[model samples]
Target: MEENAIRNKYQELGVEGFYTQYGADYSNPHEAQIRQLLLQNQDRIDYNKVLDFCCGSGEVSRTLIEAGYGHVFASDPFTYEAYQKNCGRECWQYTFEDVIRTPIPEQFSAVICSFAMHLCPDEQLFPLVYQLFQSTSQLVIITPHKRPELEQLEGVQLAFEDFCLTAKGKQVRLKAYTSTFTY
Candidate 1:
């Protein structure tokens, strides 16, 4: 499958291994920091029916739930097992192949794609993005700045970046871009 090819490529590279090696906190940026950023903008966004796309181990979903976001749907092409191991939340709707092949059946309050877009190959990037965009009114992306993967997408806008400083004081920019998607 297409997702498996990407997964295998990630495994060959160090992306998946690094994520698995250091767990959630060491994945360049942690998810809780993004949650704090989203919480600050909570007045504008609905906290219900959120989709955590490319949800590696559901760390971000757990963080969102802790921050009072209800109905968080965690989806990934390869990490739901890890998610079950990590948080074990009872929402039973996603599988490894769901994100790529299965269409998003309905609009969500917001769709959150963190760190995954950069991993997507050029051929798959736009359609995946369009699918995400078509499935939600707002798409929140927390990605590295200067991601060429997103350079040419037609239907999204940059909202604001929350540059998080680690304990070591290193700057990790979570570029939270937004867009209104209507089907």
Candidate 2:
């Protein structure tokens, strides 16, 4: 799909609605940048166990797996088929709201939310992040825009951050945060 069309669709339907309507067919146009960001930050990420939160088409999981990180898990309210087909793994059907309601059962070394954290509504971000921190000490968010600054929230501290630029010179950032809350 052309970039403009995708952007227009997203703008038309809004994030949640766009994903709800076209998630199975969804694909990240910035795969190259995402791959670069993950590869460059591999040393920083804990590979013990990682959750590919909002794992759209398993882009993050695919990159990490190809790099020999075998302990990646995934969850998305939408894109289950694409994720399973691409990553050859089952994806938990959990939305931000779901996580806030009931935290993930398993603990993770790090939870990576690529290209999706910004979609979370402002009102729910804190509760969702609080619940996520209960499941993982580290939360890694990769986004094209700088919204949803996790560090602004209490109990979340920025540990490290890096970025890769697209061909158009847009920045795609990978920011890792550690929970200050005692788990």
Off by over 4 Å in 2: none
Model 2 has an lDDT value of 0.90
The per-model lDDT (C-alpha) reads 0.62, 0.90
What lDDT score is found at residue 42 in candidate 2?
Answer: 73
Question: Could you tell me which residue pairs clash in candidate 2?
Answer: none
Q: Write the per-residue lDDT of candidate 2 for residues 13-92, one digit (tens) a residue.
A: 98778888998998898999999998898789896799999999998999988888899999998899889888789999
The parts of candidate 1 lying over 4 Å away from their true place are 1-29, 90-102, 148-151, 176-183
lDDT of 1 by residue, 15-107 (tens): 657445443332223555566656666775565888887777775687777877768887664565676677676434443235446668877
- The alpha-carbon deviation from the true structure for residue 180 of candidate 2, after best TM-score superposition, in angstroms, is 1.0
The alpha-carbon deviation from the true structure for residue 76 of candidate 1, after best TM-score superposition, in angstroms, is 1.3
TM-score per candidate: 0.70, 0.95
